[model samples]
Target: MSSSYQALKPARPDLDSAGLPYSPDYGDIYHAAQGSLAQARHVFLAGNSLPGRWAGRERFVVCETGFGLGGNFLALWQAWRADPSRCRRLHVVSLEAHPFTREGLLAMWRASLAPELQDLAAQLHAQWPDPLPGLHRLEFEGGALTLTLGFGQALELAPRLEARVDAYFFDGFSPARNPEMWSPHLFRRLARMAAPDATLATWCSAGHVRRAMEDAGFLVERKPGLHGKRHMVAGVRRTLRTPGKARLPQAHGGPRTALVIGGGPAGAGMAHALALRGWQVTVVDPMAVRDGGVHQGHTAAACVPLIARDDNPRARLARAGNLRTWARWSALAGDAAPLRCGALQMQRLEGRAGDPRDALAALDFPADWVRWMEQDEASECAGLHLSQGGVYFASGMLVRPPQLLGALLAFPGIRHVQASVAALRHGTDGWQAQDAAGQVLAVGAVLIMTSAVASWPLLQQTGLPADAAPRLATVQATGGAIASWPSGRLAGGPSCVLGAEGYVLPALAGRCVLGSTYEEDKTTWTQTARRLAIAEKMPAMLADAGLATTDGAEDWWGGDWAGWRALVPGRLPVLGPVPQLPDAWVATAFGSRGFSWAALAGDVVAASLEGEPLPLERDLLEAIRP
Candidate 1:
């Protein structure tokens, strides 16, 4: 499938005289006029035999074509909550071409929803995702229920989705008005995602829709609709199409114990994600922090997505990963909590699409995600003068690497072992980490190599085949540094991160962190402590603003921390199984945005190992797979 696609158009839901929402573009009602809740219970729930089909199962997945107002999802969730035999995990993946604003959903649902489901509706509204294109995962009831919303065209999204759906809810607009919603290609894609003996239900009993389902390998039947007002459509998956094609790998189930081979952002992230899933994780690193100490002597970094005029894979990946990180970590507390002060990414050089404003205008990205700001406005937002205009990211954050690392590792069930593994070896226990003298550091049924560039040597020692995944041998250890100055200096610094060539971070502990400089030198970052790196040329933009000068001030302290980033061929993070090694995984090759993407990478590994619904889409997971 082609990666290029247009941005999503905002949903425009209109309330009719009876306070029912209808699509103005398609000129169709959102649901049957009898009542959305009643229709959902009859057409979607009862028609699919849901609560009973999902009973006694470990996990159940449901996919809906159109999320409309999420009435069907709310109904399904409410029923699941009330069922004593409900599955351990309920995953709902829904596609929406144009999702209504959160406020619109709140107002419409509050005024019209049944009182029993009002609380769930409010929770759904509170967690409604920004209409950025691609998948957005929302967790409720402490991860027991997850909703993965695909905010884009179904035809473009269904084929790229990754799931083994147990039940399908066809709830889009009428086929006559929205033919694309009932296209053969869409049904084929849905069939491809169906689990064994999966069931489907839809209120629309159109003949074409039934034929499309039959052509896509479903056994169709007519079902009674709510109050017998009309007939509803039902389907059972008899055989899926596209036989002998490559399919998404099911989770590699094994013992719940895992051994992680690093203690930095990537490794700690994996440890925490697995820990939350009730897995016992042992993290092996030579630079492990002591008990109650968050500082493994790492530097501070900014977690802001870069802007590309074309919105390439890099841009989209960064946006998704950065958003995922914020969703996972913004709730952390205490003195070391991440600074959610946002960021000001100044425009550097001229682009094919002019500058930041033009790029944003062409993309039509949600302003809540990012907004183009003029120089004066940018200066005002940053609490300082700027040399040029650029994009302002209100979701930008400053993360202290060591603190984040510590907090992640501090989660229950994640045991930290202060030892380095010179190589890896698999034995009866599954995967084992060993030191230079052949001493074992840790062992587990599954292993995640997040040991940065050191993982390449470890993989080589384990005798990986010559024809391993493409680009496995291409990881490079690129070194860099960030200098820190007192926040009182640089005019108290900007209230947020200021990025151009080199970025500046908001102060923590009276010191502000400047951005990094890349080079090819290696360092004893793991074997030693209190390692600080020397930053490169300061941005002239800051100098012009008189925020800080390039004349080299000796007052800068906080020991500019030096570190190395694992860079892959395409400069994206590589995660997932190690080609032929089913029990082993690797999450490395995160370039400069290591901290930004680490959290999402962790969730991906966790979900994959637990046989749960994937937190990322198939195409994206493939793009970053090792």
Candidate 2:
């Protein structure tokens, strides 16, 4: 693999006379002439002895060198679904140097003659990501099935991946066409990633490839080929007669029950993730169960992605989190779904030195994801007068927090307990939560701290040493308030959420939400002053849109004010396992970006706990690790 990140150069397949996908670059066909599905089962599934090998297993992982059209993955998923004794969780990690575009994939599926294959292909295409570098995780079958698509060279990506793969599919182009993929170094990396007794199979039965596998400690065998081919190859990791360097640690089995200590976005998100994996989760919060948990009273909030000039960790995490959140919410019903109106983030001309739009333009992101809009275009998109142009996220959402939280906690396996956790202790059985009087509130195999600033005090009560975690001291609680005005007061507000120094949401439930004021020294902001401050940020836009008059803050004052606590230190959230506590994890410090960070952060935690392929790259995970 290349040493540095290489953006995917998607493949364009041409149809042969027989309507089969023929790759011009490789000068070869994608699958056997018999059929793609038939070849997949024969060369990969049966070669690895799957469905039988994975039967009754708690989790099974398969790593593949090529993901052309995703035929093998879909075939395996369909088979797993049909099997009564299939593994509870199926993870497929496939590295593709040249992935096909969504359209290309759809075209291939259309040419296919199989109905079941077409149906599965449609599902894969719908979730296909923009051919971005690094890893992109797509979940299916309610999270029971996961596909980790590595859009990079296999040599670099294989070492980066952390999985105890039970099976391997070496299905890249033929050795004659792609010698780099059949290198000995690649086989050695696969051996390092394989679990003990791991099996491997491939349609390529070249002598050199067999020798490479044998040199890498795999017991190799040549088998009869499918579709009248000459021969195929299958292998298993052979136990070494001599001891090598210490092998990588195997993934531990995650607990069946989890105790989530919050009902806010983070807690609810974690609960939903664990519940999807068949874990029984209990969420405890001081507040009563309501439509939106902690954000119940807020009329509206912006669920928009953030962009930085360099696409830093926070920016990347925000993008991943926003996408995951959208997918999760889109699957829900009733009030759980967010209003799909887009959001406009206006350019700041006050103190900032450079324009963000210029940096964004250089990135060449997809227009459907985000686009630079001039002042006139911005106004046209918002249906309100605007003084400046900024970035517009086409898929931005105006979400009601409570509604989303309620839906996340509504999973059948999730149970909510209305109580404040006064203490946390690790006993022989597992972790336990207690109230102030020392009465046990809940007990579970794992504990997730998502109570924001309150989590520090609770962590201190765990009786661990002071050095166990020093980073918790850096967390600071800041006060914030969102003021709302009667929708009728403003003749017409922006069509969607308008964000600049402060944010203004379009009318929801007869009111427009104008947020917010951040005060570190004071717990509450003067409603009049806070409203005036927000109104001052976009005075011209508000006046032009009939939201305010020349009298300055007078028209926007005297509205309702809602306050909440935001915890922040480095802006990035603190996630992953807590220090000195094996089963305890922290998912806090979300600050004002809770809506943007919740879903992805929850996924990170879930992946860590369940030993599944991570949704993020290693660098990003380390950046946010607690």
Candidate 3:
């Protein structure tokens, strides 16, 4: 399947005299006039025997075909919140071809009689995704509730979803109006995704729909309809036959403790991902501080997505990682959140064949994802003068690494241990991490080495053949430094991040970050060289922004310069398990792309441990496998 997503242009809904939402395209009311919330409880919640069915379960997943006005989701969320015996985690996956705009949803919610649902409706409105044709996962209530909204045609989306649905809310427009949603192909796809004894509830009891369900191995039965409807259908998957093809890998069902040997982006990301899945994760780093020591001194970093002519694995992984990072960080509150002001990749030379804009145009990506801008347009967007125009990423973020790390480690069940792991030992139970003093720092069911190049030495100390993974031998620790200019030094810095050979972030806290010069042999960086390097590119970027550099600007480097080491080889991170060790994984070699790769790589680690669906395709996973 194509990874690109298109934005949906939804037709506005018209309300009847009773204020019931009516769909002009489908020629059907969104819900019964009796009351949408009431209809949801009777036709969906009670039809599938939910609340009671989900009781005491570790996690329960519910799939809905239509999410008109999000009434069903809100009602279900309310029920889960009220039930004392509700499942520990509630995952609601809903598909909608024409999702309502935020204003539309809010207006519908305001017209409702149930005041209890208003608050939940507001929350949903706040978290509503960009109507992009892909699965958008939004988490709420501290990860207790997750809503995976698939914005696209049901036929195209249902088959791509990786979910083990326990119950289904099959509420679509009348089968006569939108037959594709109730087709045999969709039914069979649903069957393939259903878990054993999966139950489905639908208000439409059309004979053809019932027959399709039966043919797909569901035992269907007519039931009392909600409101004044003549009939509704409820069915459960029959276990007599095979449970269809497996949806995805099952969870490991092993111990839920993990030890991550780094406190940088990769380790913090892994800890956060695992913690969200109810794992207790401990991150060890000798330099870690409670107040964001990991990224101290560095005020800002660019979080731009990469573009490639071929859209190779590196580009694909970077794109996926960028999206995941945005979602994960946007859900965070306070200073931990990243600034979402877009970023610009300035064109280096005239008519460059490898320009990102040409590649993006060839790919025909959604405008919201990326768009080409001329120098004039780029200047207008950045609120500055510019030398060249290139591609603009609307979702690019400006993240303070330390703040982000602090936020990732702040999640409950994530402990930050201040110690250096000198060695690792894998035994029958799991893996043990020891400090230089031979003190056991942590023992976990799984071990993730995120210490960058330092991990190779630790692996060698554990008697694990580091050479077993030939790629490990190529890992090199390269050092780099980022210099900054005081905000006053430049005549109003660019409004957003600007990238060419080197990148500059919009001024943050009185300083504009610049110059990330990489050197293989140098562990330290001088202010003079870093300043000159930044100055060389500043004129081109500033000239377009209509800003002129003043005398001595090249020597006026701010105090925000700092050096750090990044592991690299092929510029692709080494992820997944070690070649010969089970339950031991490595997430390193991210190099400068740590922010761009951390979230997705961390999810891969968490998914592998949980035996859950991988966030990446198998081929892409193999490209970075350790």
Candidate 4:
């Protein structure tokens, strides 16, 4: 509609000579429109029949056209929070041609905000993207609710989205004023996003819109409108495949059953990715109880490349990995693996100096989203006191690796076994993954993602050098280190996450985690003693940055943090199809950056296995291949 965009703007709705809202707290736009509460209930809540339709469903997806002021989103969230019968997951896909600024969006949220909604609003404000095209995913409610905001014209984005909607809110402006929104082209795209029998409701009952909907294969109807309106248009998708009846079987290419020898992040992540692409996957790991067996309780890592200001393979992969991982984790919300925090990588000297930051400054990284924080701001933003300069990473967070692995294990087509894999044999048909008891666990395309220690035996016999290990010490001659402790002072810590001598997480499960040591070519149980020693040295580290305080210290939360060897060569993880074996692949060597790169690696592997378009650049994928 011509006026549809205006309706979303903070301007008077009914005024003939429209007056832009002066000093409009973005929140007031909704307040003025039948008041924010009523607008949400009538326009968004009722328009989609949310709470009622979501009852008893495992997952509910709602497609929104306007997303004005996010009032409808807030209302739907409130309803979901209040409803006991709501779906287990809520996915909201919204299209906005012109998005409001983060500051403006927060102001809008404050007008009619509840505590939970306020928290979500704050997150949205924090992660709001620049007005760029493509999808910007925002996760909330521990990943239970996901909002995929497509920042482009509805017609352009509708074709790229992959979702089946349960309901739709056609909240565009009046058809007479905003006819572009009511075009037949958009209606066709809407039809594509809807599942069979998907319901849709709109405040407008204009003849042209009804005709357009009918032409697009919806059974249109006219229902009583809200308030003084005579009628509202509602419709159901008439063109779509019915569930179960139209489901396609997994694509089998010679080898059908696949085997994974490890149940940790690398193996489990590969299993999940392959299963998503319609492969039957079996994961074998002896220590695989539930959740974290050998790899439990480890803090999450962020994907930050060791790139100077300019764009390099490291920077490109890190950027893509960051966005993809954020989206994947958001979709798997409420699964045992939940990403509770974000990460920020800051520079020691603040502004550009001699190294990477200079290259970074050249790319003009999104200043609005990722900006340069001066020393004072960086120190205050990060709870850790700092005296030196550095770039402040605002979205960094320590992740829960066990939780993430658990989520990957739950994929429908993937099966988990607790047997220790003893060997892998490659034959003409495919590969056979066997356990110590010689029981054949699986036969098909195989992916080896076992960690550095486990990988040596498997690769050594295959003529691959012992240097083909997952441990970083092979290349850098250093072992890894980490420690966790209990502390409450970090609860209300700074906004920007900081990393330097050793990274620190405020706390999860009531204790803060700190440490990590780097030793050269050491693969023993020396990590704990080193962590204890570092724990003693932490005060000096924090004191060096002017953050020494007794209140931030406490007993160790998870005992002495141990050291583990990473298989990475130059810190970058190895990914993609394994070069040695024809149908075999590998997802390993993530080092300290496992959390950030794992999900992206999974995606790349899945796409390669399925022969789908690679989501990442080809060169980047080639560099990480085994």
Candidate 5:
């Protein structure tokens, strides 16, 4: 049945006079209302027996129905952070139909939670997106914890999402008050996204809700509810096999091997995907250490598409790249390294109806999942000023590039060696890559998944300016930079990944990061005045997003800010097999779009090496070339 008839609002125990969300002051509510926070802990946390249930797993995911004030998430983060044996990573995904303003969230967090959760609270507030329908992802603590806020009707949003949750927090106000949340369809969708052993806890034990859970293949039961309430409902998910559970074939070539250079998202993703296919993979980098590496050798980046939404080459590649990269990254990092927090791109705050942002919003993708927002809603979500609205990617994320690389490199078939390969030569038997010391680092079929460094004249002989192949499109590099600041005061950051000119991460390690500048290939990573000029323009891009530059902000080294390039004419990255080189392949020209394209690129390369069907068309693959 359609969920269009759900109630817009019902009397909530936590709200005060004039419908302002508030509750009776308790110990945790001294600075704010305690109803929502206390109820969440009792119904969602204690009911699920969290911290104790997720003790042994490598990763754990929890899905909730509401993320109001983020009190529940803060408590969970705090609990997970405090637990010595907590899973290596914790993922929290929540859905909300109407989100609060960033300032309101901060005020509530400050009033309710203890000082310890304040840092995380502030970070959440800082990156909160505009109230556009979709998802927003946030990362914290070196990619150990992730928060995905789904903005839209839970019924409409739940089914569109993918990911396995270890626990469920049925946290919408009340079934009687908010009946839409207690629908059978949502329960079934929840079961679908849950693993066999998934557990759930909810404050309401209403007969209708309990029946729906049971109908949705959950082993529902009743327990004591909070605040002297009569009962609560809890359950475990039932398992159903997906269409294909078959095993994948191993690579046939003798001791199949892939060589990944340049140690960034592309290299890391390539290594990881190949390893999964049982291909022996080795990654070489010039500066990264084999152990105790500084800066972790990677940073988080995005996979956003250009504003225009059409069937052009860039749009198609962006769409394909977005889907492929998102799937692989989600599989590896799940809720840890990144959260599929959808994205929003606005034009001017006061833009007209026919604005670019509005046009993008009209794409026939998923109306309920992503739609245009009015200026007020945009202003509310971003906690800043806004002009015209923009498009929202229901499926988007902000990922820790290094953390993902670390996971990708951790695959069993992959090995890490510290050395720089100066050149490559192919013999009658096979191919050999030589390091500066002239020692043979590798001998087998090699794929040069390195950045532009390998595109230099040294390896230009393999195939060059003459045989660069006919280009379906041309692209140029644009310099970009990301700066960071401690977000100690913000609250309830965006519910989705929000980008305009440059983007801002919700917060990592209590610090928020904003980026970047797209410059013509200048070939320097330095953060120069020109780069900062682009960086400083974020305020205007997010005019409705009320963020001010921090004092003494940490100037992250935006390496060589010169080489930051994005393919011009068409903004898509060049991917797939190298046309000329038989034993070699190249995955380059992924300028600012690397984060969104690399995962998919890695998958496509792995498929190509394994002789599997690629996910893209041949013409599209051959579109981006030298």
Candidate 6:
């Protein structure tokens, strides 16, 4: 209702008389007069008994209101890193409506970071997301530490968060300066996200703030403030949850066995996400050894996000999907990660007719994500561009699906069982994955079908149609193919992705990929005209980008790879638990956006299994849920 798209604003910091960053909008210093590092340790960590509570625990979740300079998070990381009994995994979810620029944060941390945290500071600088409204997850310490930054107003974003927080850090500005942070409504929603014994700490000990916490079910007390300040506040959720309503145990709790059907991008992402969350996952795919690896099935694909005039569900999904894909695959999720070389989206009608720059201006998206590019500027970014003006994505990537799957399936807790899963049944023990002969191959407490088009047959057996998961019967498949050429042949091809009716990627492994001809059938592409579809629809689009393949390109057209896309009428990816089944999930119908949808879809399922906060908003979750 409020701008539809949450356009996050970067902080225009103002320094106080003491040389510390202050907010002219709120008329308050960023942190205590003493310093952020000291304020973080004495006020938040010690106040919450963090090191003691999280000690020896497998995983701990912390939610904070303000992530100003991220000094508190850094301090917490330092404490966790130094402690031998630290939790095996740490997750910090924080919100900031006005986040500082990544460059600004790096500069601030460079001057203030201690020796022990210098490396962490550099990582923060490297992985900090653009000031875009949504969740951006940054990982460190081999992914043992996760920081989820929500760049939006507290009232707007808190209700969308789905987490069971163990502790909270309520620090951004004073309650008097920002009343919304200490509002009764925000406190109540946060309380709903809190665990039974969840605790919180804040530098502000104002009376109204205390009353708000009490009204929101927190038992509050006034504590000694830091430095010369008079008082600080600390509290805990006072009520014990009823037996049936309590959150299910996490990594250390219960058997974490899972059967993931599919070895493609979706399934690989699912396997990686679950394995990271401590699940003993077995991936079932018969073609793994025969047709697996980077050279087979689909060699390379574009993983860029999309946008629309109205920022529709598809656009939002792409943004979230790209964020997840770039963040996860960019690091330890897999070895053959996607190359973040960026993409150039061509406006088919050119700059003068049906221009998108006007619509983009209204959206107010940060320049770090996407911005209108003139032909001259686009040429420089692309390295060999000579064509129409359009939007350039600084965060797009080119992904090798098979290589990614190979690496993801090799994660510690995931095992690859090459099996033809023909049937499924839920019985007394758990959900079972069986062969065509009815022999059970894998039995797991949780089952997620991510087999793309192949999943439809198996889904029909789950008995979910008569009860739940609507519009599933209408799922269809589309066949698509892409042509590849030796980069040596197209010597002047753009160094960035070029897209119109279809797209071409920069060279990888001495080869450039182009053309994604789509066909109505889901199983196979029409071989006769498969290579010419792109040229037929948008003639000479490649030639305009200085990538003319008119002569030698015809010879390399034979090097084409084909795949199938599972899609429904609306083209949204289906995810979440099946309505009538227990712990059974589906993440399919990605259609043509497999590379874009796979990463975030995995998160939706894993978050359900872990009972942790979701990476997406509630409305977005429902729009695609099975």
Which candidate comes out best when scored by TM-score? 1
- State which candidate has the highest lDDT: 1
C-alpha lDDT (0 to 100) for residue 592 of candidate 4 = 66
Tens digit of per-residue lDDT, candidate 5, span 76-157: 8878878998887677788887676555566655545567667877777766755544455555775467676766688776
Clashes of 5: 59
Better of 4 and 6 by lDDT: 6
lDDT of 4 by residue, 193-277 (tens): 5666688878778898899888877888887776666888778777764322231111235655677767766676677767765
Report the C-alpha lDDT of model 1 over 499-598, residue by residue, as the tens digit: 8767788877778777666667645343112222223334534635344563445545554566677898888788888987758899999889878888
Off by over 4 Å in 2: 1-5, 16-18, 24-28, 176-180, 184-190, 211-217, 240-255, 289-293, 350-358, 465-467, 488-491, 539-569
Candidate 3: give the clashing pairs.
Answer: 384-545, 385-544, 385-545, 385-546, 386-544, 386-545, 387-544
Q: Give TM per candidate.
A: 0.94, 0.90, 0.84, 0.57, 0.54, 0.91
**Comparing 5 and 6 on TM-score, the stronger one:** 6
What's model 3's lDDT at 22? Answer: 82
Question: Of the candidates numbered 4 and 5, which has the greater TM-score value?
Answer: 4
Report the lDDT tens digits of candidate 6 across residue range 322-434.
99987777764553788888898886644334557865786788887799888788877777644566788888888876677677778899888887898999887778898
In candidate 6, position 114 carries an lDDT of 55
Candidate 1 vs candidate 5: the TM-score winner is: 1
lDDT (10s digit) by residue, model 2, range 377-483: 89888887777777898778888777888888988899988998888888876888899899998988888998888887888877656566556646787777787
Candidate 4 ranges with C-alpha deviation above 4 Å:
1-252, 299-307, 333-340, 348-360, 446-450, 460-478, 488-496, 521-529, 532-558
lDDT of each: 0.79, 0.78, 0.78, 0.60, 0.61, 0.78
Backbone atom clashes (below 3 Å) for every candidate: 3, 1, 7, 46, 59, 2
Ranking by TM-score: 1, 6, 2, 3, 4, 5
